[model samples]
Target: MTVFLIWSCSGKNASEISNETLLIVKKIEKINVLMGSAVGSSGHKPNQYENFEELKKNASKQELITLTNHSNGVVRCYSFWALALSENIDLFSIIKDHINDDTQVKTQFGCSGSTEKVGDFFINLVNPKDEDSDITKLTPDEFNKLDSLLIHKENNLYARYDAIANAVPTAYLYSKVREMVVKHNNQNALITLSKYKNPHDIELILKNRDPDEDGESGYFYTYKAIQNFPDPIFLPFLEKKLNETLDNDRYDGEWLQLYMAIASYKNQKSLELLTIPFTKVKHQDIKKYHIKFVYEAIIVNKSKLYDDLLWKIWQDENIITQEGFEYLLQLNKTKTLELSKKELNSNYQIKNTNTIPKINQSMFSQNLEENMLNFVLLNDKVFAYNVINDKIINTNVNDFEMYCSKILELKDPSFTEILFKRLKNEDNPHVYLQIVETLISFKDESINKRILETRKKNKNMNQDWGSEALDEILKKNKIK
Candidate 1:
């Protein structure tokens, strides 16, 4: 679980790399110099943590350059990292050329390899689905180069992979652009790669974005190609592929990409799209795509949207079975809650942290309530929460305890009346415990009622659960 943390250059003094860092770099450089092609283990560098790492923190601009040039591949990788951090535009072309070099080392006389464009490669990795990065930590100049490189052309994966070594955005390297990114400069490269299911080579293209000094993106050709064939076989496969990939951890940013892609889908079909197997997926990120995709479809298809599919999925207990309901609760309140409220049942019980209030106040607040009310629920579930200084806290909300808490919180006597009836009729132990907890939370007054109630609920709850909870609270409060 060792994640690589690379420092990218934006616009800073490349020459200013410090000297203290150079001490370690000098050693690594010597190793590279002495060992040559065999510098790393069997032609590759050792673990990414090269010995030079210790000096990296306080490294000045000059020392950084030396460290970047050290003999090891790990060292060379850091070079890109240092340059990215510098944010100096002048170094970009230089670094770009270095990565663009198709010149492979003479491992065996002359076994040269690809000479792909590195610009597009790096950009693609940063935001695989092309979501913008929060290089805000980067100076203005640093981001400018990234913005400049987003659509730059590249020949193979090396450039992109190396670029990945240079930067790590939260959601870069999207699977959506996997096929397209591989064919950075080649117009019909994607078509060839996908075997013409996506004919015209430039079929589903990104927009006309000129990220280089020339400011000329090949969007027109790609668009014209997609338009060339209104209905292509690849589109269905593309949709299916996206749906299938939702179960994977690799597509961490699938939701963002699809959200953006669907927005641009001038002729997208919601029925077919909604029917896609988002329900069966096991990843949290992928489920998010379903919600996003549906939202986009709703906006575009409107009357044509067959929301019944969503309703069915909403009611499905197993829909979120892949991941836990707690994860579903983590979704942006504005996004899920708003959508949910539109279709959620009255007994919706939230199973996770309600950061929804925070999100509702942010830019995404538009649909807070709508999303919050969407979670599927039952009438008898316990929905109890503890408030410590007005901040609500509910420790256990597994499918076992949500509804009871919700009903217990009601000030009205009618809620209790409903629970009283359900308590007598329902034999589910979890349900009974929930009902009891609500009553206990109710007027901590009624000591006799409380003891009897606690005793009865205790019988139904987990063996030691009620006693343990009371003991812990009493230990803290030291009450009689």
Candidate 2:
């Protein structure tokens, strides 16, 4: 078979290139482009190779052999695997040579020590001897080879983790993994142990509870291990740490770990332990630290016992700030929204009128701005237009619309300047029209004059939508 490589010739069209040449050129280009990207991250673009298996299916034996000698290691590795998958047993010698070659390949998990990974990939392609023999059923020799690879510190971390994690959960493998957990305090090793859930291994994990050499606390690993194992024995240890930390003045980071561990327990006792501090603690600072974990515990357990407690906390004016309100809304949105509506209405006057009433406009404006600021600051769910600051403080479209609705309902002349500024800058014709309608409802002469001027200027530039909307508004009010 002939191989085709794309060259830098100008004025070439698709019709001029042979179908076979185009396919080969595309495959080679893909291999070259993808080989340099870092694995296991966003840099690895998989869509480029979506048709890789299809291309492999159409590859000739000669083409596969030629690819094995390609400069890009990934291309070579893939070509060898494709040949192996097609059951081309006659090419085993050539494949082995490629596998034993010193050329390094950057794989999905980064660079392998040599072509050793391709050899592993070849092993994966071979079927098991029996129905019960899975990929994990490796011979003693194969297991040892993988174990050596796993223990080699210079190997890629993901490669090492994958080797042990995918291996059969044998006694020897479990013991080696436990040693890795203790020595390296690796999160992956601990997770691998959790897969086995060996009782003796739990004690080993507990013994090596200190932070790793990298200063990353082992509590996360412990939390994950307990989640997998679900042993009751660790509860007392977790509770003791929680109590000790709460007693101390300094709220070290370890307390968070302890709370997380206790939450992971997902037991009645753990729920009670989490709830007691949230309910009994009157100190605002202490409650603040523990409330997040308490919320997590409640959500994790799905316990109805904390419903009233959460509601009580939400109603507490001293404690229910923007963050707390948002948390409450997340937990029980229907109830919180109902409560919020009532609270908001009682705190501020909301009127729906077409005309601004002549009732102390200065005092009403001041009160409205102050109330709007308070509402915006206290409730994370509400958006506010700051009249003095001349900015929309929040980006939520629904919240902004609600604030605009309130301004229109009250027919507040104080918001005329900011609203006009926003209307002039807004590119969306529909939203600009709505703002014009709201402005017209205010019935302020100065605002009407400004709108008329803006409409005339827009008309001159052939940007006549604003002028047309303002004309409709003036006609509706029966103004000349």
Candidate 3:
């Protein structure tokens, strides 16, 4: 049957297009050039893809369908998309034949882009609940039929997984989904199977998983599936994998998922497994990227079991000190403040490096800059004034502008003199302006006299905004 279809269509081969087909082919090629390297949303470049609309309006439905099998993957996708959106023909009928078409195309939706197989693209176009796309919506019956088409073992692997995931829970769908997962070693399909939370499915994933035979891809999806359906039954496997990664230093991009999956178990052993990287892996880059997952997992566990580990990380000055500090801040307030005071009194030197470890931003209510200030302030208003004074007077401290801005946010009068002292000696026009602005924010009468004295003393300073700011302060205070 396949040979017959190929032989019959060989006469009107894409290589030798008739005059009528030539125009549609040229328009399709233009859509490709205008879209550049990736197919985007219909509105991504409306003008560029207007060619598709032109073909939809003037070209016969057969013309568009014929182009679905064109030599170019882009042509095939756009042609199918045109048919799917037009609604003059049944999209499922057209898409059913192409469920196994594995030609890949680059697609962009908003800021994200990925290379997707053409068959998956067809499936996604009519996937229910995607109101944002231009494709026509399908009836529930049609959707079930579409998913049934994809659940066939012969279909594209991703499409099969996605269909099994979305299809109604039925004996056939479950059987097909399980068959693909167990028999074919389709680990990605395991993500869908694990969603059912079946013990048998979990055992299948565990028994079928041989990281040695499948390497890290199998482990990656297995970890993802386990993350979706976390169970204590898989704890030993996760622990062994965690140790293997730590001991071999072989974190081939599965560190975050693996760490969090183990962390999901949330037992003393899991906590110990998550902490292994801090002491075991000597690679700084890996630690920098993945330490937050470990920190987040431990903090969310809310167990003091890891307090010793957090304190150890805090005491040892390393790349992840901020993570340790913030973790302690969340889990142990008294200890966090004590550590903050110790660091403040020592005026700890923060090493300026290209990469700065941030407090896991989502976990905190405050943004990164405010959270950095809290690292010093400890959220204690009384202690913040003293720390601000100490940091401002040091002058050698890094990130001075950031510290100065915090003083403005605080709007306290005690910082006026400290800022004034810096202002009197500070020659950097930018820093001088920040100090003046911070002092002005204090709205204290004492700053008026101090400003007048400083302005008079520094009349020779070459600051563009220097005199203007001082004059504004004088005018605002009505001080001549």
The residue ranges of model 3 lying beyond 4 angstroms of the native Cα positions read 1-25, 30-72, 79-98, 106-115, 122-149, 162-172, 195-203, 210-218, 226-239, 271-293, 296-332, 336-379, 386-408, 411-480
TM-score of 2: 0.44
Best by TM-score: 3
lDDT of 1 by residue, 1-480 (tens): 222223323322234334455555555545442111224334654322354345445565555554344334434544444454454434444444344433222221122322222333233323334444521133346444644353244434354433332333322333323345453543433222222224333334433222342212223333333333334443653464455555665443334334333333344452555455455667676566566555543443333234444334545521322122223345343334433433333344434443443332222223432123213221112221111101112223343343344444444334554555455444454555555556545555553254445446544333456545644444443333
The parts of candidate 1 lying over 4 Å away from their true place are 1-53, 79-98, 101-397, 400-443, 447-471
**TM-score versus the correct structure, for each prediction:** 0.40, 0.44, 0.58
Model 3 has a clash total of 0
- lDDT to native, each model: 0.40, 0.54, 0.65
TM-score, model 3 to reference: 0.58
All candidates: CA RMSD (Å): 14.3, 13.9, 9.3
Clashes of each: 52, 0, 0
What lDDT would candidate 3 get against the real structure?
A: 0.65
Clashes of 1: 52
